[model samples]
Target: MGLEIRLLTARDTEAYWHLRLEALEREPKSFGESAGEHRLSTPESATERLTTNPEDNFVFGALLDGDLAGMAGFFRYTIAKERHKGKIWGVYVREDCRGKGIGRALLAALLEKIKACPGVEQVSLTVAAGQSAARALYVSLGFKTYGLEPGGMKVGDEYLDNEHMMLKI
Candidate 1:
């Protein structure tokens, strides 16, 4: 069967949980949250995350054979004046499923969701510095790096930097 790209929901909690844990564990510096922080998260909260409250948040998933293969999430600022922009985060593809366009698919779908939002005119995201593949992917999809956050994160003693990119919708 072909891969399916669509919105994730509360019913996808089980698969989503495991897939997200993989992202946190396998690519610690690439994400904002550590696996330990996510491990403390409850299943109910994960499910709640999948339940889209479109004005502010949504998640898109890429599935193959009914398993979650990748995902991307978007969050819009709820403050009155900042609603015109959104941020994309939590982008990941399953290890065994990489190099197969799943991440691009998830990102494309997420962008479409953002376009559907009435006031969202732009979307921004941050990628770990030196992550060429992911940065290239975002660049290929029309995102441009506007700045860099030097030593944006510290994992143990290693300082991780990030590149800030934005796309005009």
Candidate 2:
């Protein structure tokens, strides 16, 4: 059977936090910071993110046989000038579950969700420069490279570049 993709709700908070921390711990380079940083956050913080208003942001998950395998979400800009855009973040997939389209499923679901939000005309995301598979996946789904941020993130003693990508909704 194929993976099941759906929009997450408040009831998913615990599972969402578990998988999110797992991603941050196992693949720190894939995201902006380390799980250790979030470890300092209170349970309220995790629940708040998972329960964010769907009108402003929506989180989607891809479950493989009822197990959360991947997740992604978007935060719509609040500024009047940028209200037409949304920033995609919190993207992750288990290392062992990647390449099977879970990432694509999560992205696609979140994309549709954002596209339906009021005033959201575009969606943007950042991917590591060397992650060709991720870049290709985004490009194939209609995102285009808008720019590159050199040394955008520091992982321990190393710096990594990131590519800014956007898709018009």
Candidate 3:
């Protein structure tokens, strides 16, 4: 596979939006957003999401043979007291592209960019409690479990808990 990991831009809005919707549809439990909600979003909104502001927020995409196979996003907290912390969100790799290192590469690239952001002392993320593979990958990348949020998300009548983790840079 001709794999490439790079920052996503406005030109990548369509691919990013499609992959994001796929993630929300196929792995609803893994994401905080619902597919229904995403379906209601406009192309302009998707384009805005891909707008890169490195010091504040950005997304990294993993392309396999020029096709978007995975993506990960990062954003720094805007609150004055929380400005030193960054959060990782919307991480997903296509089901057909799993078992490869696409997730790792996307995350590695995101982390490298995060390290360059001024005042970013640590990175944090939440993984659904049942997602062992995702949790393992985060742990392998030096994130430590800080706490568990009970009922972090709800899908229909079911509630899913999330494990909060952080990596101090």
Candidate 4:
């Protein structure tokens, strides 16, 4: 099957929210949140998020066998101190779809969009320190760990370390 990458639209609000919450729930250790954390958001929140910046903040999704198995997004760093960079987030592939190059495709597509952003010189993301597979993929894509944060997040009963990484374009 062929892999297709496309921009997320208003029509994808529910799917986007569902897939992201699924990722956060399924891989609680790899993400910043626990399964129950996202319950605070209402459908309005999801729609607002989807509609606010569909064009500037890009979300690239990968379809495998007619199903969307992975997604990644990046938002331009709007602060004056970090205007030359974008922060990547919501990067995840379905559990059954991992290791099949879908994650790579999703990340590459997001990076390409980031590179096209005027004045965007780098992309930054924080990954769970113990996620070696994701870390290796970032390295292969030219991302380097810049530093580490201790007890960055508490997922359920465990505190996880976070590795800050960046890719200079």
Candidate 5:
């Protein structure tokens, strides 16, 4: 897939908001933020949310046919002592766009961007434990499973385990 990956900014707020809401509603457990929380945000607030520090925080969008097909976000740990560690979050591709290497390409592009940030020695991300395909994709990209948080995420009455993975970039 000759996917066009772009780093989004404040100007892309509308598209980002819609796509993010879709991802959250479609796959709730895959994300930490709930759609309800995001629904509380107005377009004005979305501008603030979408506009982030370019050097340490940003989102990568995978565009196929000129549409926002997928997205992934990267951010540096905010704590002073954890400045060397970065995090990859909010990785999701549209259902129709899945299995086309879009997700993989988005991640690859995100890693490439993370590489440009000095002092970022390692990157970390977490996935639901049962998502084998996502886990395999991360592993193939050189991420190792460091730990598993049992019942890390609770969805209604059931709890889902989360796998913590890290890449020594």
Candidate 6:
């Protein structure tokens, strides 16, 4: 399969929304947002999000044979004091596509774009505890764990912890 990594655009809104909901539903504990919440979001919102500013906010998508299979996002903090930091969010690879390094390619592309943004010194992300593969991927990319947030998410009476990690660019 041909793998292509590129910034997502408004034209990809529908596919991106579907993939995001799939991520939320299939791996509920992996994200901070719930499928229920995402279901309430409109396509217009997704389009707006995809219409990003490369300098501060953007999403990278991995397409396998022209199909959206993985995605990663970045947004620099807007607050004056936190402007030097950015956060990675909504990282997911389709279950069928997991073993192909799509996530790594998506992240590497996102990180390369983040590095070009002015004043962004560090990038931060949170991975749900117990997700060994995801954590391992982040570590392989030079992310260092800084702390853990207990009970970061609650799904059907089960509390999930999140490990905070950061990479300095």
Global Cα lDDT for candidate 5: 0.87
TM-score of each: 0.96, 0.93, 0.97, 0.91, 0.94, 0.97
- Please give the distance, in angstroms, between residue 21's alpha carbon in candidate 6 and its true position after superposition: 0.5
Better of 3 and 4 by TM-score: 3
Task: List candidate 6 stretches off by more than 4 Å.
Answer: none
Positional deviation of 20 in candidate 1, in angstroms? 0.6
Residue pairs clashing, model 3: none
**Compared with the true structure, what per-residue lDDT tens digits does model 4 show for residues 24-103?**
87888887655576767777776676567654577887877757778888888678998888888888988887888888
Poorest 10 consecutive residues by lDDT, candidate 2: 45-54
Q: Per-residue alpha-carbon lDDT of model 3 for 1-169, expressed as tens digits?
A: 9999999998999999999999999999999999999999998998887784555899999999999999999989999999999999999999899998889998999999999998999999999978888998999999999999999999989999989999999
Error of 2 at 82 (Å): 1.2
lDDT of every predicted structure (CA atoms): 0.89, 0.84, 0.92, 0.81, 0.87, 0.93
Candidate 3 lDDT trough over 10 residues, lowest sum: 47-56
lDDT score for candidate 4 against the true structure: 0.81
Residue 143 lDDT in candidate 1? 96
Query: Could you tell me which 10 consecutive residues in candidate 4 have the lowest summed lDDT?
Result: 47-56
Q: How many residue pairs clash in each candidate?
A: 0, 0, 0, 0, 0, 0
The candidate 6 region of ten consecutive residues with least summed lDDT is 48-57
Residues 88-107, model 6: lDDT tens digits: 99999999899888888988
What TM-score would candidate 5 get against the native? Answer: 0.94
Model 1 vs truth, CA RMSD: 1.1
The TM-score of candidate 4 is 0.91
Best-fitting candidate, scored by TM-score: 6
